[model samples]
Target: MNQSAGAAQHTHRYSVEEKIIGLFLRTITQVCSAFIRTAAAAALWSSRLQMLSEQSNFSDDENVPGSSWHTFSLQFGVWKDIGPVGPDRNWKGIGISLLVILVVLSFIGLSIVLLSKDTGSKTSGSPLTLDDLFQRSFQIHDPDAKWISAKEIIFQRWDGNVFKMDMNNNKTELLLKNTTFATFKASKFAISPDLNFVLLGYDVKQVHRHSFLASYLIYNLYTREVQELNPPEVSNSALQFASWGVQGQQLIYIFENNIYYKANVQSSSWRLTSSGQDGVVFNGITDWLYEMEVLHHQAAHWWSPDGSRLAYLTINDSLVPTMFLPRFTGSLYPRGTEYRYPKMGQNNPAVGLHVITLDGSSFTEEIKPPDGFHTRELYITMVKWVAQEKLSVRWVNRAQNMSVLSLCDTTAGSCITKHVMVSDKWLDGQNEKPVFSRDSTAFFTIMPLKHSSHGAFNHIAMISNHSSGKDVSLHHLTSGTWDVTHILSYDESTNSVFFLSTEEGPSQQHLYRVSVMDSSDKECLSCSLFRSNCTYYDAALSSDCQHVLLNCRGPGLPQTTLHKLSSMREFQTLDESAELRAALKNRRVPKTERRTVQINSFAFRLELILPMDLDETQKHPLLLVLYVFFFKFSATIPPS
Candidate 1:
């Protein structure tokens, strides 16, 4: 009876959003599959390491005194295949002793694995649920810009369709529709900093069996042309548009650990800055964790607004210990993938800052840290050149308690550590990157502010029986319950600061553009520039601040659309497909709506999206897990 109920529940869940659910289930399954593949790879590599060591032993050229440099070979005796004392069966004492020792060692190894760590700790595991992906404020900023473009994952669908919606003007154009191939779904994309070109990538099969593939396509807006940037013959995809070299003339992308560069508008040569191998100087780029987590960027290097010399990260990984993903095989040997990841309490990769001079042979300067904290405790995520000779660098300490923001003079090779930001929680989870003012005068940090007025439990002291104290500042930013959204860019021209905030309340993203009086006062002017009444809004600003793009989703909209912020007018409406839209138009159905929910003394925007088949009898399981570097809950029903 219980089995039947469970099956019914599972079936009901399928009705929710089969497309998204299938993707989730597939994503989850791939985790375990990848884990096994990694295990197998580690095993094979272990054998290769042993073989290489043995070959070195054989090839060793040992020089003996009073003798010419000649190859030396070691000759050792071993028990023969023939029997021992009498005729056939030989009782070798060493073989029995080896067996006993192996048994003892195997027992000890098993015990250590079982007792030292919990088996559940191996996998990162699926976060809370589908809805959670959108709830957290991971990539939020001050005074959210009007969005220029967007990429939204739809439910009940497999193929990733990318639509470029121009909010405020109301023109929804399809850039890349869904593909028939499931594995070739468009996963990531980037527009040239010049806004002239676009790059799209899809995850596919890798060159080796254990590797995964990433492919790219470059779209030119002026020429209305489309071309594949990567060579068709190679097995690689994980490609990205690192940064625009000035007029979008040069392109930078990463394939595995290697950084590739290509010039635009001609038959140009591809230059390799990184070669996947360690100990190489990386030009115009950052590493995986820094890109994936910290700076909220995929490109390691950044071209100045002028696109002159590039400011980027150069990782020195000669110290970090590599942890291999282990794969188990049912066959004679297991196949797998490999990478070097620094485990907790282990030596991490040494990070440094580098400035690449594009005028000639690139010159490099190492922004080495002063040896005070242990080397393993430092993590660098973002670095930007403040001027032709000045650089801004941020590093999170090992304890994650405080991150010291520093300015480096590339001219003198000097570093002046400035701001010290410590987490009020006292424990650092994944932290966000700092945003610099355009002039590079001051930096911004979006931290949590505890609310003492509500009398809620606050501090998570690193001790047993932690005190449930009220919200208060102890060398912190604020003393109330508020988490800072990301620190958006500063507009020096107007002395206006932009960022997203839950200062009103969480669950909704509101635009807050604060006008600063001076460095001392730091007071916000009452005359506001713009505000959004919705939960999810992404914005981009023009240099003059006259034009702003706001991508928003209000109540009842499954897909997000665009809007112009200043006028708060509809720019473009994003739809699923032409056919679907026509079919829906044929039916006289009620249009969806966005509600103004009161939150934090402010009316917050909340939009709703529902299934086409709105039968009350129909039930779909809702998954609400927040995504990394984001602050919204996205829901997707899994396939049964």
Candidate 2:
């Protein structure tokens, strides 16, 4: 929907009665606040006057203490210090008394007004409508926090300014001002490894689910300068993809289907590949089939840890059938565009893994698949750099029934299978990247393990002797009925692997830290915090493993908080959704109930959201939507 349509749907006009009630409540609230402030001021003045009176107590014959004003001793000074003459004696005391009376009167008035409006305040507010839900009236505000380093975090404000916050001092400094590049709105940013330069992409035109064409620009944080990120051959043009390298200000981008590189923000661009076709062959980026079915990511490139080599996939879809989509705008007759989309029993795109050294000259070396696998029938599911010269890649067959994890030498472009997994049923499309040991001899990945009679649950297991090209032994690091959802981080300093799991329940996810040396030594980091409303959670750890950003995606309102790892204490609250909570306080929202239903040997969770005034005794229409595949896959993965 367009912006105007969205705004119109969220807008609501208040009824006459509602407007009147709202006006009355606002007026009463304002009056009560004013009265309270006035009463406080009056009480303060009365106390100060009493103190002055007590301090001004001086004997009339003592010529009054500090009596430099005795020169004006026309009886006025004596009268002023003492009291008024005649029936008006003790005038200062009387003034203090009047001030006290004023304070008491103000308090009494405020109390009466509050008491009078108590009944009105007790009335239930307006009923919640579909408009509220559509408008996301209760959605919490997130600060969009990202960790730039162990001791610092970068977050964007609502006004588009990015800020850097130091964890030690809790001080925030402006990193990027929105006004600096006000020419266009950037949809995303890629910060350099040094955190000195930011690559911004604007004028984004989405091509697929995760791919887009955007014009890129570079902003220097130190100099506060902005420059277009166009290659020398191309000026003011949109790029297919762009990102920073792992070291310094080195960067890479894809223009006209070809890969380009820059040593720094101010350096000239170099074309890395020349055999890129618009729809046939993709060099650094993925095509529709690879992006949607295999990798599930836009880019197929992986930079080495030292930024010395690049590993990317080349997908050729010339033999694949084309799918045409019609465009319905800018013409009387609709014009259509063609996309290479492979269907059942159709030719799949042939994929090849290639490695290129980035030391000035470039000659791409193709990394062949393992034995018994052909490049035409294989899919590269995951690519990760293990060391400066070693790369790990997972390849699955076209049927997705067999997967092979291999380690490749970047210098030779040769690979050897480290582990092989075969299943009678379809395997998980893309497995998570295995966290490798520092020495690259061992690694950790999630595999299904049988626990008692609960079938097989996904657990973390360490595989050793991977580098020896021998049969690796798997040792369980975590074993339970609950599934480990993700491997978040591995802290070498603490020898701890942090992960998220459904230990609390099927609907809940919590962060956990487990020792690699001792699997039995495990602790739940986020379980004790927010036990009331928060259930589902996700986390992002800093590189040094000193801090984490815990996201509470909840049964109640979601919140994001930064926490210190050592103490497990909250360091900062990125967002608590205070405004959203206030907006929902008086709303008559729907009631929800959760229940577990046991059918034969399987237990299924059921959640029902009912109307606020629902009548259980009466028959009501039911709208039931079932996600069979998702539920079954999550329940358990039966072993082959």
Candidate 3:
């Protein structure tokens, strides 16, 4: 019985030893599996990190995703929580740890590289500076601003080459090349009436408000020849005025204040006036006062529509008071320049309206002013040839309160007043040239309506040119609350008047066509017909009224466009400021807002400009701009 008990105890001990061995083997297996899993995961993560790093180096996209260092750290922490396997079996764990560390390092390197690249990209395209802003703020003129001939726009480029662009297809062709003439370059140019010659002004020096002294050149289109327009007596004297006559290649110029004429390129120049004296008398050209206030033109001359006669103003400023202007340039002592400038209630230059025949008949006749006015102070505001033998002259009193429109019979040398308009305020209608009817029996002018809702808004009126007294009947043509800002043209074909008005709004100007036969028939041509981006507008109509050059001035970017009148479709964009817009695409710009405030009986219009990215929570300084008439106010805000 004792031997049996010993064998049983031995068996129990063996059983316990076997169970412990089995338990160790199972634990070892589990550790090996965990190590294998950790190693596999590290390899996978390492490969992924390497792939992501390579992609980041060459990838164009910035939103690519990769294993972050935090995520790797969290994963590594979880793996570490599993604890290192037994030291005898921890080799796989160590290798996995090394791989994970390499992946983390790679991720850090790639992240730094990506951040640097982003910073470099941001630093490359810098913001615009003050100098850049000023440089780009210059006005870019619409090439077709001044001269458009025969459906073609003519302009001179900076290189002094003249080009003509066809409005039909926007095709341009070189018309004249630069011709050097004695150290002078062509600075201004105008085409002839027949488009056969280009009159060029070189070495131009501005003298007064509207007058310039320049040497002249005549460029022949057919022969491609350039000729100097120098008078025989003077070698290089600057001409006061050089312009094309109404006839084909006929030229008229003023030298030293005297008028000279040329029938053609090969013809000799003849002196038309010999009474011109420096600072005393000016013939065929305005003095400083007339240029500044009355005519606003350099030449005070008019050519007959048939090109048969020339009407000019002979201004005598001998008795007018002299004003001195100081000139400060490259000199220790400033020199005072004396000019005849008449102030209010002072004696003005005596202006006379004279008509001279261009047919070699030295017959010059003067149209006397009216019955009761001092000739010395009476100002001849406008002179336009209405017919071959008749001319329209406007005379305003020295006080500028009363105006008299007279029709002068050039053949009879007699002037008769047709209408006398008296205004309590200053009369502004003297600058408007009346549009005569086809038969010259009536003329159209913008006159204040007797009864209107808008309080003395100017409207088109047809007045008889036959009446000899102030009782002439005036027929109202266009009656509305808005004022007709300007009369563009009188279409004889349609018996309609084309004008620009503030009919749309005070801030906006649009073209309108109104019929004289039916005063109620009017059409707004440009109100609803822009590219949804333009607000203010100005237009230049073709001679035949078949096409119009529309200038879209902005609340946005300004652009010039050509359109067909018949179809009202955009032909082409002449100047869109594409380069300027492109440069400003990524730059900050100021925001503008317009509002009108009514204070008592006065309504004041104001425009505000706010800085870019303006925050309402922050305080901003304000600026108030005021002008004499306060017609428009524009503000600019700098970037923060």
Candidate 4:
């Protein structure tokens, strides 16, 4: 009996210990499974919230109720709301729960790292949309005449009112209102020399680069009267050319391929030339060949300084060939347009220069070409009045290897060759005009720099008009390794010639002043003027060199300023681009980098514009742009 009791007690104790061990393992499995479910629910909720946040457009004053932490807590409460422990907890459930929790937590941490890596750093700039391209902005128009006097400047506002800004206080005064003249919108206008009338061009159609056909209206400033400018013979036809005469309210215009004159508004129009025919001949206005190649101007006419004489070219194109171009405008059959085009070794237009006196008698004379040129084949490249009765003409051979600058006696109707420049290559005299001195006894022009070691560069040379014979005495006025681009103006008071030159750098053009008497007294006017903003400049000086209109282009936004010519101080700002600067305050703008690379003896200029937020370590695609004969390379990277 004693042995049986002992065995029963030991068995009971072992059974109790096994039950405790089982209970401990079950508790652990349940805890782990709960944790895994909670973790999975948390990850799923986070992903949903992230997606919603990305899709939502939140305003500053609005709140997102679904993204609050309280929502997350409520979701976790669903697991806790299920009562105490279940009896089926196992090791397999614990293992799966732990594995799932590890994966979800790892993924969440990786996502957090990736999203936070680029915070506070800039990304590539946004690409331009169609809206950016087609949208219009407020812009200031460049003044018609560069050297407009402060008293004569009149600006047309967007509301169709004319205003004049005061230079003393920067105040604006209304000159004309749109309500006064509602029938016409002036596309271009010019003030008469007397400042009493405005020549307005309306309903304009462009015919070429420098020519237009338009209906003209003359507005009287004092009387507030507007009248159509039409001759009695062709009342409704478009005028070929209309421009202000040198004096009073006088005007000259071209019509029906011929030149016409008006001494004043009340005077009857008089025809100056009667040899004009359609497609065969043109008077006072250039034909296609002359306009394209020789003159590069539509009106081949020039008025004398005193407004007494008019010199013009008469072009005969009857022998030239015609080229037809097709005009397509969504039509069933395309229309053809014909134009006179002179090809290589073909028949060119015959050109002649004629002068007409504006007196009541209407005397006319033809200034014949020099004896050396074939008048029919040669080109009358340039013409200018050097004096009241003397004119300067430049004539070039058809071979383009020789050019002669001649002085024509208008009274005698004869031309005398004053100077001749010959070039083994082609002489580029068509675009250059000789600059005469104040006394008209000497003239300046650009010639190759003698004994230049660096390379061939153009410098200013003076030719004496009082030469003994055909051989004129030439003197070098300026010499350097740099090239003078153009002669801006001559100041007779100071005896100084202002010009543009590439003296500071090859890509830079700055205003320079050099004395005609000294030649060594040189000054750079624009190099240090706008040190940071402008690298290229052009200037228009008043007749007396008292005022200047300076055009600053490049390196930054372009600016136009009115300045005192003597001091080079800014008098007024014409255009400051205030609207454009305000619009670009928050946007990314292109940045330019200019570099010069030297290969052997040649230097190539390169301009590179890279994308914003450029990455140096990554390879990027590039676009290269090259202009023929310019040797300029530019690269632009598109935004990603």
Candidate 5:
């Protein structure tokens, strides 16, 4: 009973015609979801990330050799602004000549000050590592929308030499005692759709690289006890996808292209839905090429919000052309890493999207298509069941010139479409997140208004699928130039969307709130949430929608702080470890002194840094000066 390969596909490859139709459906769905998701998960991570501080660095400048270029520039900018601009742009005029002469003298004085100043940007010593970096980069008092998420607060510290922090009585405590490393590591995590727990992780080297079972430890989080969610024996595969359900414990992850599910989080038993290892048929995981170039993930998959079925993009890369590049390690011969890659306007994976039931029984629906579509592998931005049987998936076209949002009717197994968005240039398709309202009648999407090259000025479009016997149209949200840094929060309970915008000035961010409404444009009823921004960072709202934990930077100190933002913006700084505090206190405190100098042909403003530890205030030896990048640096005191 071996059927022909062509005869076996209940869901065949999509023709260009089918892809067009799908594009239409997804666009409408995206607009509708954008309206809903705009409110649904807006507050998802913000409640957990809240940190802001008002502290001061010992000195804003340091005139020391090998100081960072940024620090020197900071000092230089301050010194130059000390004088006003010259005589209203008239240099040859009488009053202008005096202004010019005086300005020139001032410049010379500034250069002299720089030459004599002891300014240093960085000390590179072990104790003053990231803390110093944070303080400088983050300024919570006048922040550019900075945020820090103190992810895990554990009882017992995590081993493996990783930096750890713990929460103890309204303050964060450094728990990993007696360890040489004093800082935490960057987290690679995927939060579950259920929003109950976050799936923290490692790369392929830790998981499936050797054997799948051996690398299963990554699935479990917080045995050390900060926030624990119960889930059955679910092992995160190497180089794959995993997510939570809307209800918290339900989980889905890809294993060998096959999609698997565990209903209860605490159980170890699982059942397979697709026999994806057949190598030809892909289930939940994306093939290497699609995951790498287009999707930005090694896996091409997603979880439906309600968490009933898993919708995934499958790639049939068997026909794609492969190119080989030689790896020469200065040897006579070289080996190569062989794989499939799509060149500009070239062959790509035959893209297809499908929905599978959680029971491993059958496909809830398979999108049928024509042969003109490039169906080998498709770039699926996201998929969700907007309503009971209507699912939406955003699909990008092969040329990368346009993206098509498709809405599929699960029960009918067909899709009525709309061409939501079309771009003539490259764009960040992932930014096209589809948000749905609680009732699932309408949604919204924020997409590029012009071409991708000018995305900093993109427009937010609100599309509706309500039908209502009228023209379901698209509405624009932004009036002027603004780029979104983070959709900090969306509260359906309160009917508002909180997002960070750069409309104030380029490179600086501010928090803004917009009301969500119905067809009449009346305000929607939701939560009464507050907002706060001390410095520039991103944040995520917690599940309760009341808490926010973030990394905030002040004048000289950037630390993690937790805030109960929904009710009030109160500062709760994490406590520092005694050892770390002691180390910092004992380190050389560099004080910046302003000076001017004339070095070569350039008049410069300099920052002089003198060590504070010396008993004799003015007397010191070896005021060695070093010039780098044409900027002179010196220290009034030498290292002991």
Candidate 6:
């Protein structure tokens, strides 16, 4: 008896659903058919009238009055004679045809309104205007803070004064007054390792992406004294770059393409290289190809952990071809400037790795590239100091499909290949600095691993550094369908590696910590915090890994905060962006939806920024924004 009742209910439900779908389809079909027929009839009569006028020789008469209309009227009369020949009959037929067309058009219009109502129209709020995009109503506040120590951070306030913030007590203190170095109109500043001296960069000028030229001044924090880095007697002595060493107040600057070293803020500068040639050889800095495609940074120098030895690249572009770009403004004749640009199958910059000692006895050692690259052109993509006596360098072939990571002995100037990565497709320059374990026996880097037929996703991979040559083994530290975007820091105390990953979704980035000893012991740090507004995030960990500086960037107004990792509690709110939140509360804003679509055998991440109120039945224009950088490609579609 129960089986019979169940079967009857199922049959009734299926019939009711079928009837509803049938009614919808039939209504659509009837309205469309009627509209098409009426439109076709009107179009036929218009085309016939045009054809008759074109076939008549009287159409060419220029001295005639309404000659084309007269021809059309004569054709109408011919048709009328075949039918019920009379003036009133002709008028009556046209009126009836127009009435039928109007009725069909009205029916089609009414059907669309009904369909929209049935589907539930999403039109409620105002639509975003063009001005809203250009002049964004939603403002994001960034602290632009950098960690100086485990419990301290340094940031510049809006008034240009630098402040020091303590993570423990949530207290802020002014470190440097804006007016102290305001005479030079300083635009950039870097604090020394001891946090005593500040290097002020002024009169800044752009060279290329992530590179600039500026005049620097050294400011004493206690004494409040300032002095120019370059001597006043020297003509046009702006430096290409300046940075403090990892220890004390040791300074290094590039002037006239040569690297110069200063023992301290009061010491005189000593030249390190004299082979710098104009537009030919670049010392301690990257050339066009290296900065644009390879290293993606201007600085080509690396200091050992103890700051005793320095490793730098001497790029010789004398053999490479030069391209002259003409400037047409501000002169009667155009001015041309030459740039070292290597085209396809051309000579790239000859890159040589050199290590120099700075402990009293100054000497230089040239480290040769790895085997199979001595006779072939190779690009230096990464350089890092693994130990006081050892440094790591990554070398890639001309096609960038193969990469070799070698650990070099700074004292002996000899390198042993530790790991090698090869791919059929081009390799993304591994520009990330690998975090070495406490014993320096292993290092963590991001690599791709195939997971469950979703294709390969980026995950954290740890390779044994103690093993030399190409026989090293890579162990997976983190795994999933999502990708690990960057490695933030490694804590030796907890044996945990912190990194940013798209574990939540592709459009969102959150912080995650995984134990190197146990791959399954992983926890998300930022997933539960600020769940409503913050989706994308960037974080920086202090040297001791006790605190984290987090930047919450959009799906809403951006926010910056500091957190104590031990308790997983928010230490402080740096910027709440209350003004921006208030401004957007009453204004219309675009909404973003993250979706993943499968095409063929590949899955692609798609982000759609739709209008506030979207009507499915109405036609809307689409705008596609494509961004291509390095080997990465992303697409954003917005309503137009």
Backbone clash count, each prediction separately? 75, 0, 0, 0, 109, 0
Candidate 5 deviant stretches above 4 angstroms? 1-214, 218-253, 264-282, 328-332, 368-378, 385-390, 416-419, 427-431, 449-456, 467-470, 485-489, 516-535, 543-560, 565-568, 573-640
| CA lDDT of each prediction against the hidden true structure | 0.48, 0.77, 0.73, 0.71, 0.47, 0.76
Q: Write the per-residue lDDT of candidate 4 for residues 401-438, one digit (tens) a residue.
A: 88888888887898777788788877764567777775
Candidate 3 per-residue lDDT, tens place, 1-640, comes to 1122222333222234345555555665566556567777776666545544544454443333542221122363352222221112235555776775566556556555555453343334545567766664333444544445648776544344667778767788887666642234676777887778877788889886578898887877788687889887977778999888877877899987899988877899989999999989999998888887789888899999777788999999998998887767879999878888777777889888888888888789888889877888688888888888989888888888998988889987897887789989888767788888767677888888855444787888888645454446678877767788788878889988888888877777788889988988999888757655676778888877778877888666778777787767656666776767767655555545555666688777766565444454444455545431102345544334
The local distance difference test score of model 1 is 0.48
Best by TM-score: 2
Per-prediction TM-score to the true structure, in the order listed: 0.52, 0.73, 0.71, 0.72, 0.53, 0.72
Q: Pick the candidate with the highest lDDT.
A: 2
lDDT of 1 by residue, 1-640 (tens): 1123323344223322345445555554566455555655655556444444543564443333333222223447432222111121213433444555565556556545543343223222333334433533221212122233233211122234544444345454554444522333555556564566766666544332222346776667567576666532354444434334555566765554555556564444355454355323334444444444455544566665455556666565556665455456787777654544556777666565566655546565667664464445677755666666677677777666777666777756777765555664443433444555544545555444345565332221111111122232223222246444544555667766665555555565545565554433233211142333345554554444544444444322233333343454434434323343333332333323344655576655654343333343455555555653222447766534
> Which model, 3 or 6, shows the larger TM-score?
6
Candidate 6 weakest lDDT stretch, 10 residues: 80-89
For model 5 the local lDDT of residue 462 reads: 60
Q: RMSD of model 5, in Å? A: 26.4
How does candidate 3 score on lDDT? 0.73
Worst 10 residues of 2 by lDDT: 629-638
Which should have the higher TM-score, number 1 or number 6? 6
Model 4 segments more than 4 A misplaced? 1-140, 148-183, 328-332, 467-471, 583-587, 597-601, 607-640
lDDT of 6 by residue, 245-358 (tens): 989999999877788898888887778888988678889998877887778888999998888888999999988998887767788999977888888898888999999998
What candidate 3 gets wrong by more than 4 Å, as runs, is 1-137, 145-173, 177-184, 328-332, 450-454, 465-472, 553-558, 578-592, 608-640
